[model samples]
Target: MQTEKVVNYIVHWLKDYATQARVNGFVIGISGGIDSAVTSTLCAKTGLDVLCIEMPIHQAESHVTRAQEHIKQLKEKFDTVSDTRSDLTPVFEAFKNEVFFDGDQATVDMALANTRARLRMTTLYYYAGLYKLLVAGTGNKVEDFGVGFYTKYGDGGVDLSPIADLVKSEVYELGDFLKVPESIMNAAPSDGLFGDARSDEDQIGASYPELEWAMKMDEAGKRAEDFTGREQIAFNIYKRFNTANKHKMIPIPICEIPSNLL
Candidate 1:
């Protein structure tokens, strides 16, 4: 892809969309991941007010450091860029106290992790409403469309997605062109929802590159039987996520009323 052209296109798209919507600018959660770094940079290039928020809930040190580094770089590079930090650890703990823990350990843990994402989403939207800024999504093609690896109405909740069309590799290319912090470019991709340093691959059981390959295969109508060994395992992993998380990828289903009934 023409990296420069792609960057310009996204910047223009963002500016145009915000202009049409009459929003002042954008607000995004900075997770220190490649997707957020690239996305925040793209928004900064739009020459509109961009707020980078850090909402951490038991987040790992490395992730926090990288997020801070990236935001600092963005503020230095773009006059319209600004940042704020909100420690959601206490809020998460309070929420856990109010909720029941009747489920198994793994199940409860998963739900709580998703809660972290939802909290951050709420935080971003709060700022967006206060500042009249649009909530900019940081999801990429593989995570947003291919694997559906995001929390519904959580991180998936956004006013617009600037990088959803670009795959992980393509996002990295944009990151390079945008001069994102080196620490982020070298860091492992993660959701940071679990409050640990475990990478996204560790949770999904497949790396971005592997998932990207599997996504292409599935789109080309290839089945698991077509591959063997590691390839088959990766393909199956991709399919399982794509199928289970399909709800996040599509619009919510609605019951249509029959016109005759009225």
Candidate 2:
């Protein structure tokens, strides 16, 4: 891909879309990950006001440090870039106190993790509305389209996605080009939703390069049986996530009444 050209195109696209929508700027959550770093930098390049928010709910220290470093660099490089940190740990604790817990430990833990994401989403939107800024999403192709690794209505909620079309490797390319903080660029990819340093590979059981290959193979109509050994294992892992998370990728189901019934 033409990296410079793509960057210019996305910058122009963001400026044009925001101008057309009559929004002043963009608001995005900074998670200290490559996708967020790349997307936020692109938004900054647009010369529009880009508010980088660090919303942490029981977040790991490494993630928080990287997020702060990236935000600091962005602000130093771009005049239009500004940042604010919102610590939401209390909010999360309060929420847990109010909600009834059910199911096994795993299920309950998963729900809480998702709750953290939703809280961050809500925080972003609150600022977006208060400042008339569009909520910029940081999802990439692999998470947004291939495996649907994001929580629906949580991190998935956004006014625009600047980097959603780019895959994981492409996002890393953009991050490198954008001169993102070295700590962030070198750090392993993680969601940071679990308040721990569990990498995305740990969660998915496959590296991004492997997952990208699987996504391409799946797109090319290659099934798991077509490969054996490691390839098959990776393919099956990809297939399992892609199948289970299909709901997040597709449009919400709607009930359409018959003409006569209407």
Number of the predicted model whose lDDT against the real structure is largest? 1
Report the lDDT tens digits of candidate 1 across residue range 178-217. Answer: 8888899999999998888999999999999999999999
| Stretch of 10 with least lDDT, candidate 1 | 174-183
Candidate 2 stretches with Cα past 4 Å from truth are none
Per-residue lDDT over 140-223 for candidate 2, one digit per residue giving the tens place of the 0 to 100 score: 999999999999999999999998888999988888888988898899999998999999999999999999999999999999
Cand. 2 Cα-lDDT? 0.93
TM-scores for all predictions: 0.98, 0.99
Q: What is the lDDT of residue 154 in candidate 2?
A: 97
Instruction: Give all candidate RMSDs, comma-separated.
Output: 0.8, 0.7
lDDT of each: 0.94, 0.93
